[model samples]
Every structure is written in C-alpha cells, then in structure tokens.
Target chain A: MLVSLAWRNIWRQPVRSVLSLIGLAFSSLLLVFMLSFQFGVYDTIKIGALGLFDGFGQFQPEGYDDDPDISKQLPGSQALLAADQIKGVSATAPRASSFAILANGDTSFGAAVIGVDPAREPAVSTLYSTISEGRYLEPEDSAAIVMGAGLVRNLGLALGDNVTMLGTGNDGAVAADVLELVGIFSTGVNAVDRQITQMPLARFQETYNMGENVNVIALRGPDFNGVIRAAPDLQGLAEAEGAVYLRWDDLQPEVRQMITLDLSTAMLMYGIMIVVVVFILLNTLYMSVLERTREFGGLMAIGMRPAQIGAMVWLELVFLSLLGAGIGIALGAGITIWVENVGISFPGMEDVLGQWGISGRVYPDLSFFSASIGPGIIVGSIIILGLIPYRRILGLEPVSAMGAA
Target chain B: MKPIVSCRGITKVFGKGELAVHALRGIDLDIMEGDFATLAGPSGSGKTTLLNMVGALDHPTAGEVAIDGQPLSGMSKSALSDLRLNKIGFIFQAYNLVPVLSARENVEFVLRLLRVEPAERRRRADEALAEVGLQGMEGRRPSALSGGQQQRVAIARALVARPRIVLADEPTANLDSTTTKELVDLMYRLNQESGITFLIGTHDPRVMEHSKRHIEMNDGQIESDTRG
Candidate 1:
C-alpha cells in the first residue's frame, strides 16, 4: 500500500517529475558517450603506434632494445617461427637493426638500418605499402635498400642512386657496402621517415658479417586487445628462446602514461557530472516533500509511523531514478552502436590527431560494460542520496505538518 | 465506569521565554466511555490545544494525559504513534482525506497502519462507508466528492478502526447547515450504535446541541461544564 501510494504521488505533479527524469536521462547519455569516445581514441593510438615497426608486441635479445649492438643478436629465426604458432598470432617478422652512416655525394647522415626478409617483412609491417617511389626490395636483390623519404632528402639522394654505408660488423671487422636506394617511402611519422632504412636480410648479413642471426622478432595479432591476451603465451615462447618479451606497454611507456593521464582527467570530469545530477535530484525531491507536508501530517495523524513515511519517499525516488536510467541506457547504447559502425571524424583536426599518433576518425566502444557504467552510477547515487528526503520526512511533527498551509 | 480519557492539570505553552504563549492553563477533565461530549469555545480559547494533548499529538508542558490507563507523557514517539493507531481515531476540520486515495482507501488507511489483513480491512471500510451513505461512492477520490461527502468519508475513516475514542476538531466547519446536521446525525448514530466515545472541539452551537455534555472555554481556561 505504501508502495502504491508513493508511485501515485510522483505523478501528482506530472510536469515536475518528467523534467527531473529528463535531466537524469541527459546526464546518463553524456556520460556513456563521453567514456566510449575516450576508450575508442585510446584504441586508435595503440593500433597506430604498434603498426609503426613493433607489431602489437616484440621479442628481442635481453639488452638489445637499449643497446642495439650487432653482437647482441638472437640465436636464429627458429624462435620467431615458434612464436608464430601461438593462438591469435597473425604473423611474425625477424629483423636485425643497427645504426650506420650513409653518404651520397658528400652528404652523409646517420640512419637506423634494418635487415628483413623481403617476403616475410610485409606480413608483419605496413611499411611496404607506404612506398611512394621505386619498389620494395626483391628476394634476391642483393645490395638493394628501401629508405624513408626524409632519409633520402637528408642525403640529397633519389631512387636508383647508390649510397655508401660504413659500420662495424659483429666480428669487429670494418663493414662497408654500396647499396642502391630502390624505394623511397613516407610513413607520415616524422621520426620513422627521418631515420629508417631497410634492406634484404641475406645481403645485410654478408655485409655486416653477422651470419644468419637476427636481433628482434616482431609479432602481429588481430587487434590491440587480442595481442594483450596472447602476451603470456608469447612470453613463454620468448623465455624458451632466452629472449625477453615486450608488450605494447613495455615497448611504449610514454603512450601508456599518456593514456593513464587522459583517463584520470576524464574520470574527474565524470565525477563532477555525477555530483551535479545527484544534487538536481535531491532538490526536486526535497521540494516535493515540502509541498506535501500537510498530506504527510494527515497520514501521521491517522497512526502512520514516521519511518513508514520515510520509506514512501525513498520508494518514490527509486522508481524515478530507475525509469530515467532505463531510458537513458537505451538511448546511449543505440547511439554508441551507430557511431561504432559508421565511425566519427573530427574535421579540420587531422594535423592535431596525426601528431597524437591517431587518425582523424574514431569508432566508439559499444560493449555492455561500457554502456552500463553511466546508468549504474546514476542508479546507485539516487538510492544513496534518497536519504535526504527520508530524513526530512522523519523530522516532521504531525501537529505542525497538519497545520502547515 | 472508568474514564476512557483523563487529563490532570494539563498546561501547554507555545514557544519559550518572552515569546511564549500559554495555549492551555492547568485544566483538569475526564470523560467516561461511550460519552458524546463537545469542548465549545471561540478561537484561541485552548479547545484545539486541549484536543491535541488528549490525542497525543502534542506534549503538555507541566501535566499528564492518560487514555485507557496508559500515561502518554513518558512514552516514546513510536509508542505514542502506536497508541493513537490502536486506541484513538481523528477527524480534522479540513476533512484530511488523502487526496490520492479513493473514499474506501482513505477509510481503510488506518486499518492498514494497524496491520490488519486486506480482506477484513476492505470489508470493514465498505461497511463503514455504507453506514455513512457513501457505499457507491467508495471509488471516488476526495476531489471528486462534495464537501458533505468528504466529511462523511472522514467520519467513516475515524469509525472504521473501532477505536476507543474519536477526536474531532471542527469536522463540520466546512459544510452547509444541512450537511452539518446530516454529519452530526451520523456521528450521534455511530456513538449510540457502537458505544464509541466522541470528544469534539468546536464553537458551533449545532455541534453543542447534538452532544449530551458540553465544556466551554475562554482565555485558555474552562468557563463552564454542563450535562443534560
């Protein structure tokens, strides 16, 4: 009976109740969409960065990442092939990288050169498709090199130009080679374009006297999350090969820190939004209770306990919050799913997004967990804050309430 | 017979210090069971204040009120509420029917507070409404009923619980002469038929004429007491 009375009472002033409901719904919608967009942007950044060279994650010699010395090389390509056997491992590429000096007609600059198998490198990295001039290295094309556009510009060289490379080999001998620049690629990433140069693995090994050893084994998976799930198994494989596994977080700590900072700032804003919504609900309910003082007094005069009156007010709030949250969840989820499918783009922000390692377009995350977070916080807040009106009802004196005009 | 309600030197003061207004001054009174009595007085004459004290709705400053041998002064708020629910019913000047409830629901409200089963509460509420000539109008809200009908519903609500005492404060003040007479006649009939005691606070001569006993007040003191 109390429940029935409370349910009917909220409708006594239909406009006021409806307005409060709309406010609650709007808050939930904004919260859900905001969180989904933030997570989507993070996903975009991870994919873009991992797509650069290290695909999803990598396995390298224990200290090779910090000191890319030719001497600290992996045993063989067998470990890289073994890692490819793991579930969800799309592909793997083994590469030997070293810093060397390249000179074209007296213009000499330092460049990071990578030795990769022509056929298998494309399976792990998208660098092959980014070629702007000439062609990628052929399987038997000895002394051939594919360099970034920035590197070519720095050395004042063009396609078909022969560049001289000078470096020390793994056996401590002078390693020298004159290589033809067969390809000029532009990755749009300033760092990669300015320093990276790739060549066929066999020619690089013969020039550097490194035999068949590779320094790093890069692994690619379906997506960022799928790669993270496969990390433990990949780590087990790396341990067997006496190598260390580096997940995206370990490989790109700066990106991880950037995401953490952004999420904290977003959560702070979400907290303020929740507080504002809770206050609005409190004000609406407090006014409603005050207006019905005389009615409450009448109930108390007829032997209704103060506790029962409090319970009635609480039930009314619970019903209103649940109704609003339900509607908001439906609207939020619908919009998120649509955005996820079609994607949303920030026009005129391409340069800024590119600087942050993301494309202008983003897809909102529409998972069940993401959709429920907003409405869940709202419902929990309303039930907890319902105490405001309950305390007010309990404090009312029947005689005073009855006499209130 | 023992008095169903008794008051001893009851004093009630509103506010405190220089702002205090003494609404009741050391009044003593008693009414036996089944008595139909009226406390007749003009406005600000302590009639309503005394009624409030007797109903356990307000606490006396320096006295005590007892109903059916239970002292009300020292009881907890919940205990006092329980006392009112079990032993007393009230009819207000404003009718005080819960506006959202239908006529039958308003009458059954007290039974619900008393934890009475639904079937018995409905049966008693229906019977009480029928007795007050509101049988077919049980489904109508207070807003849909006439002033006279609303007052009748209030009367039925007060009597439905079968309490020992029914406290009425100007229950007929909002009705016309004909409606007032019909309401008075209904209360008189209920008092006679069920042996329920009635303690009414009002200055209306019509209400005084229907009662067997009258106590008139002036300036927060009893000026006269009479019985036919």
Candidate 2:
C-alpha cells in the first residue's frame, strides 16, 4: 500500500517530476556514451601507438632491447617460424638495425636504418602501407632501399636516388653500400620521417656480415587482445630460442600513462555532473515533502508512523531513480550498440590524427564497465542523498503539521 | 462507565519568557466510554489544544493523559502511533484525506497499516464507504468529492478501524447548512448504532445541538458542562 501510495504521489505534480526525471536521464545518457567512447579510444591507441611500429609484441635476444649490440643476435629464421605458428599470430618479421651515415651529392645525414624482409614487413608493421611515394622493395631487389621523406629530403635526394650508406658491421669491418632509393615514405612522425630508413634483409646481411642472425623478431596479431592472448605462447617460443617476449604495455609505458591521464580527467568531469544532478533531484524530493506537510500530518494522526512516512518518501525516490536511469541506460546502450556497428567518424579530422597512424573513425568498446558504472553511480547517489527529505518527514509533528497551509 | 479518554491537570505552553501563551491551562477532563461529547470555544480558547492532547497528538507541558487506560507521557513515538492506530480515529476541519487516494482507498489505508489481509481490507473498506452513503463514489479521488462528501469519507475512514474514540476538530466548518445537518445526523446515527465515543472541537453551535454532552471552553478552561 505504501508503495502504491508513493507511485501515485510522484504523479501528483506531473510536470515537476517529469522535468527532474528528464534531467537525470540525460545526465546518465551522456555519461554512458562518453565513457564508452573513451574506453574505445584506449583500444585504438593501443594499436596505433604500438602496432604502428613496435608490432604489438616482440621476440628479442634476452639483452637485445636493453642494449642492441650486433653481437647479441638471435636465430632470425627459427624464431620467425616459431612465432608465426602461434594461434593469434597474423604475421611475424625479423629485423636487423644499425645507425648509418647516408649521403647524396653534397648533402649528408646520419639516420637509423633497419633491414626487413620485403614480404613479411608489410604484415608486421604499418610503415609498409605508408609508402607516400614510389613502390615498396621486392624480395628479389637486394640493392633497393626505402627512406623516410624527411631523411631523403635532408640528404637532398628523391625517388630513384642512389644513397651511399656507411657503417661498421658485426664482423668489426667497415660495411658500405650504394643502394638505389626505390621508395620514399612519410610516416608523419617527426622521429620516423626525419631520421629512419629501411633496406632489404639480404643486402643488410651481406653488407653488415650478420649471416642469418637478427636482433629481434617482431609479431603482429588480429587485434590488441588477440596479440595479448598469444603472448604466453610466444613467451614459450622465445625462451626455447633463447629470447624474451615483450608485450605491448611493457614495450610502451607511455601509452598506459596517456590513457590513465585521460581517464582520470574524464572521471572528474563525470563526478561534477552526477553531483549537480543529485542536488536537483534532491531539491524536488524535499519540496514535495514540504508541500504535503498537512497531508503527512493527517496520515500520522490516523495511524501512520513517522518512520513509515519516511519510508514512503524513500520509495518515491527509488521509483524515480529506477525509471529515469533505466530509460537512460536503454537509450544509451542502444546508441552505443549502433555506433559500435557503423562507428563514429571524424570526417574532417583525419589529418589531425593521421600522424598517430589513427583513422578518422572509431567504434566504442561497449563493455560492462562503461555501460553500467555511470548509471550505477547516479542511482546510488540519488538514493543516498534522498535521506535529507526522509529525515525531514520523520521530524514532522502531526498537530503542527496538520495546521500548515 | 469508565472513562475512555482522561486528562488530569493538562497544561500546554507555546514559546517561553514573556512570549509564552498558555494554549491549555491546567485542564482536567474525562469522556466516558461511548459518550458523544463536543468541546466549544472561540479561536485561541484552547478547544483544539485540548483535543490534540486528548488524541495524544501532542504532549502536555505539565501533567499526564491516559487514553483507554494507557498512560501517554512515557510512550515512544512508535508506541504513541500504535496507540492512536488502535484506539483513535480522526476528522479535520479541512477534510484531511490523502488527496491522491480514492474514497475507498482512503478508508483502506488504516486497515493496511494494521496489516489486515487484502480480501478483508477490501470488504471492510466497501462496507464503511457504503455506511457513509459513498458506495457508488468508491473510485472517486478525494479531489472529486464535495466538501461535505469528503467529510463523510473522512468519517468512514475514522470509523473503519473500530477505534474506541474519534477526534473531530471542526469537521463541518466548510459545509453548507443542509450538508452540515446531514453530516451531523449521519454521525449521530453512527454513534448510536456503533456505540463508538466521539470528542469534537468546534465553534459550531449546530454540532452542539447533536452532542449528548457539551463542554464549553474559555481561556483554556472548561467554562460550562451541559447535557443535551
């Protein structure tokens, strides 16, 4: 009976109750979508920051990443075959890297150089797709090289330009080459475009005297989670081959740092929104109790306890919260699910995010955390804050209250 | 018969210092079981204060009150509420029914608080509404009823619980003469048929004509006690 009474009481002033309901609903809706969008971007960054260059996870000689000496090399072919057989592994590439001096005519620049298999590099790293100019190197072209647009420009060279690379090889001998630059790529990263270059693996082995040994075997997967699941299996493979497996988070601490900072800032804004919504709803509840002072007194006079009156007020708030937030969640989850399918696109914002190897569109993650946490906090807060009006109703004396206008 | 409602040296003061106004001043009174009594006075003459004290709605500043032989001074708020629920019914000048409730629901509300089963609650509520001549208006909310009809619903609500007494504070103050007479006659019939006690506070002399006993108030004291 109290429940039935409470349900009817909220509709007594339909306008006030509906308006407050709308406010709470919208706040919850905005929170659900924003939190989901934010969660989705973390997955995007996980791939863009690491999969763009570092290949999600890696297998390297135990000390290769810490100190990339030519001597600390692993069996490239064996490790590559072992990594490719993992269930989630989509591609694997062996890489040999060394710093080299490049020159074209009167210009010269020192640049980081990595030798990669022309066939496998395209699958493991996005750098292959960023061929801003001429075609990528073929497996047969041992003398062909690819250079960042910035590196090529700094050397005063272009496509089809012959660039001489000079470096010390693993044999402690002077390694020299005059490779034709068949491709110039622009990675949009200042570090990569300004000072990085790549060449065919066979040529690197012949010129640097490294045989079939490479410093690291990089691996890629279907997605961030797939690659993560493959890590344990990859770990076993790496150990057998006397190397260590490095997951994306361990390989890039800065990405985790960036996500944590962004999430913290979003949480602060959500906190403020929830507080404002709760206060507005609380005001509505308080005023309703005040307006019914005389009626409450009459109820008390008949037989109703102050505690029963307080419980009625509480039940009213609970009904409002459940209705308001339930609708918001339904609407929020619907919108999120739709966007997850077709994705949210930033039509004119491609160039802004292109540098990070990010596309113009993103799909919201839509996990339980994003869907439930916002509305949960909101409804919980309204119920807790409702105590103010409940306490007020409990304190009313029947005689004086019945006399109130 | 033994007194169903008792007040011994009851005193109620509002505020303190020079601002203190005595609402009820050292009044001693009792209404025996099944008595239909009325308290008449002008505004500020303490008729309502005395009624409120009798109903256990407010505590006296000094002295004690006992309703149906139970002392009210030391009772907790819950216990006082239970006492009121079990022994007293109430009617107000403004017809203080919960406006959201239908005429039938208003009567069932008290029975609900008493934890009566649903089938029994409905039957009793229907019977009370019919007894007050509001049977066909069971589904009508309090706002849909006239002032007199609303009072009748309040009367039914008061009696449905079979309380020992009903406290009515100027219950017909808003009604016309014809409606007032009809309402008074209805209460007289219910009092005679059910043998339930009634204590009323009013300025209406018409109501006094129907009462079996009239206690007139002046400056918080019983100025006259007359039997009709």
Candidate 3:
C-alpha cells in the first residue's frame, strides 16, 4: 500500500513529475555518451600514434628506448621469429636506427637514419602507406632509401638522387654511405616528416658494420587488444634474446600523459553533471514535501508515523530514479551502438586530427565501465538525498501540520 | 473500568510570552464506554483544542489525557501513533480522504496501518462502506463523489478500525443540512449498534440533539454539561 500510495503521489502533478524524470534521463544519457566518446577518441589516438612507426608492441635493446646509441644492438632475427609464433601477433618487422647527417650540394640536414626490412616493413608500419611522392624501397634494393617530404625538401634533394649519410659505427668507425632516395612520404607529424629517412636493413648493417643485428623488432597484431594479450609471451622471448618488450602505452608515454589530463577534464565535467542531477532531485522532493504539507499532516494525524511517511516519499524518488536511469541507459546504449557502427566524423579537420593520430572519423568504444558508472552515481544520489525529506517529516507536529494551510 | 476517553485539567497554550494564545483552559472531562457525547462551542471556544489533546494529536500545556486507560503524557510519537491506530479514530471537518484513492481504498488505509490481512481488510472495508450507505460507490475517488459521499467514506474509514473511541471534529461543518442530519443519524445508529464510544466536537445543534450528553464551552472553559 505504501508503494502504491507513493507511486500515485508522483502523478498528482503529472507535468512536474515528468519534467524531473526527463531531466534525470537526459543527464545520465549525456554522461554515458560522453564517456564512450572519450574512450573512442583514446583508441583513435593510440592507433594513429602507434601505427605510424612504433607498431603496437616492440622488442628493443634493454636500454635503447632511453639511449639509441648504435652500440646498443640486439639479435633481432631470433626475437622477431619468436614473436611471429605467438597466435595473436600478425606480423613483425626488424629495423635499425641511429642519428646521422645528410648533405646535398652545400645543403645539410640532420636526420634519424632508420633501416627497415622493405619486404616486411609494410606489414608493421603505417609510414609505408603514407607515401606522398616517389616509391618505397624494394627487397632487392640495397642503396635505395625512402625519405620524408620535409626531410628531402630540407636536403634539397629529389628522388633518384644520392644523399650522403655520415655517422659513427658500433666500432667507432666513420659510417659513410650514399643512398638513392626512392620515395618521399608525408605523415603530417612534424618530427616524422622533418627528421626521418629509411633504407634497407642489409644495406644499413653493411654500412654500419653491425653484422645482422638490429635496434628493434616491431610487432603488429589485428588490433591493440590482441597485441596487449601477446605482450607477456613477447616479453619472455625478448628477454631470452637480451632485449625488452614495450607495450604500446609504454612506448608512447607522452600519449599516455595526454590521455590522463584529458580524462581528468572529462571526469570533472561529468562530476558537474552529476551535481546538477542531485540538485534537480532535491528541488523536486523539497517542493513535493511543501506542496503536500497538509496532506502529510493528515496522514500523520491518522496513525501514520513520520518514518513510514518518509519511506513512502523515498519510495517515490526510488521509482522515479530507477525509471529515469533505465531509460537513459537504453537510450545511451542505442546511441553509442549507432555511433560505433556509423562513427562520428569531423569534416575539414582531417589534417589537424591526423597530426594527433586520429584519422578523419572517431568511432566511439562503449565499455561496461563507461556505460554503468554514470548512471550508478545518479541512482545512488537519490537514495542518499531521500534522507533530507525524512528528517523534515520527523520535525512536523501532527496537530500544527494538520492545521497548516 | 476507566472511561474510554478521559481528560483532566487539560490546558493548551500556543506560542510563547506576550503573544501566547491559550487554546484550551484547564478542563476535566470523561466519556465512558458506549457513550455518545458532543462538545459544543463557537470557534476558539476550546472544543477542537480539547478534542485534539484527547485525540493525542498534541500535548497539553498542563495536566494529561488518557485514552483507553493509557496516559498520553511522555509517550514517544511512535507510541502515540500506535495508540491512535489501535485505540482512537479521527474524522476531520474537510472529509480528509486521500484524493487519489477510491472510497474503499480510503477506508482500507487505516486497515493497512493496522497490518490487517488483505482479504480481511477488503472484507471489513466492504462491510464498513455498506454500513455507511456507500455500498455501490466504493470505487469512486473522493473527487468524483459528493461532499456527503466523501464524508461517508471518512466515517467508514474511522469505524473500520474498530477503535475504542472515534473523535470527530466539526464533521458536519461542510455538509448540507440534509446530509448533516443523515450523518448525525448514521453516527447515532453506529454508536448504538457497535457500542463504541464517540467524542464529537461541533457547534451544530442537530449533532448535539443526537448525542446522549452535551458539554458546551465558552472562552476555553466549559459553561454547561448536560445529560438527559
């Protein structure tokens, strides 16, 4: 009877009740959608930044990530073959990289010289697909190299021209080479486009007197999650080969830091939304208590305890919040699923987004965490706020309350 | 046995200091089991104030009230609620039926408070509504019913609990003369048949005429106490 009475009481003012319900539902939906959108954007950043050159996971010499000196080399072929045997790992590419200087006709520029396995590099890196001009290196080509658009432009060199590369070898020998620029790529990332050049791994080993050793064994998988699941196995193999496995986030600390700051800002906004919802509930319940002042007095006059009345009132809010949260979750899940399929696009911003590793469109990722945490806060707030009216009810004297206008 | 409803020197003062208004001046009264009594007075003459005290709705400034031999002074609100639910029933002037409930639901509200089984509550609610001449109108909400019909529902609700005493405050104030007479007659008949005590506070001569005893008040003090 108490539940029935409380349920009926809400409809006594239909418009006010429905407006409050809609307010709660809309707030919950916004939180869920915003959370899913953030997750999707994070995924976009991870894929874009990691895919360009770092791959999802990588095998590097124990200290190469901190200091990329050519002397710090690992047996890459053994580690690459072992990583390839992992079920989820789709591909692996070996590479050697070091700082070097390129010169052409009195023009000179410093570049990061990257030696790649031309036959297998395409399977691991997005850089191979972002070529803006000229062709990538071939498996049979030893002296051919691919340069970024900005790097080649700065060197004042064109495709088919030999650019002189000068650096120190592992034995402190003067490593000198002249490489034909076979391709010019544009990745939109300033650091990559302005400072990188790739040549065949065998040619790089010969020039640097490194003897089939490489700096990294880059691993690729179907997606980020697949690579994550394979990290432990890859780590074991890398350790055996005197190297260390780096997960995507470990490989991109700057991206991880950006994600932390962005998540904090997003959560702050969501906190404000939850606070707004709390106020809406407070307003509705306070008005309801005041509006039914005489009615509450009447109930109390006729043997109803204030606690019982409070329970009835609390039950009303419980019903409202449950309905609101349910509707919001359904709506949020629907919108998120639709977005996941069709994706959300930002037009005329592809160049800007590409720099940060998000292609033109962002597909939202809806996880259980994103979907439930917001609505749980909303529902729990009502359960907690329901006590205010209960205390108010306890204060009213039946005689005076019944006499109230 | 003690009187079903008892009051001794009950004085009620509202507010404090110079602004204080004495709503009830020390008065002693008792209505025994099966007694039908009416408290008659003009507005602010203490009839309602004294009734509210005896009904355990408010505490008296001085002295005490006892219903069914249980003193109301110093009792917790929960204890008073339990007393009211078990020993006294109240019918107000405005026919205070929960607007959203049907006539039968209004009567069952008290039974629900008593924790009566649903089937038993339904049986008693139906019987009480029938006794109040609202047998067929049990499904009508208060808004759909006439003022007289609403009063009948209130009466049914009051009696359905089978309280030791039923306290009615200006129950006929909002009714037409025809309905007023019918209500008084119904109360008189229910009191006689069920042998339940009744303490009514009203200014209507028609209601006083139906009561077995009359206590009239003036300036918060009783002026006359009459019996046949």
TM-score of each: 0.90, 0.89, 0.91
Candidate 1 TM-score over all chains jointly: 0.90
* Each model's lDDT: 0.87, 0.87, 0.88
Question: Of models 2 and 3, which has the larger TM-score?
Answer: 3
* Residue-level lDDT tens digits of model 1 in A202-265: 8888889988888888888866788899988988888887888899988888889999999999
Q: Per-residue alpha-carbon lDDT of model 2 for A1-405, expressed as tens digits?
A: 889989999999999989978987888888888899888888887888777678989887777777878777886457455677788888888888888899888788898778998888888888877898998878898898999998888888878889999988998899899999999888776678888888998889889999877877788988778889887788888777777888887778878888889889989999998888888888877888888888889889998999999999899999998888888888888899999989988888776666556677888888788988998898999888888788887888888888888
Tell me the DockQ of each model, to 2 decimals: 0.69, 0.81, 0.71
Which 10-residue window in model 2 chain A sums to the lowest lDDT?
A75-84
Which residue pairs in candidate 1 collide? none
Candidate 2 segments whose C-alpha is farther than 4 A from its true place: A59-93, A117-120, A137-143, A158-162, A170-182, A200-214, A225-250, A335-349, A362-365
In candidate 3, list every pair of residues with a backbone clash.
none
Worst 10 residues of 3 chain A by lDDT: A75-84
Query: How well does candidate 2 score on lDDT at residue B147?
Result: 93
Cα displacement (angstroms), candidate 1, residue B97, comes to 2.7
lDDT of 1 at A336: 84
Cα shift from native, residue A345, model 1 (Å): 2.0
Model 3, global lDDT: 0.88
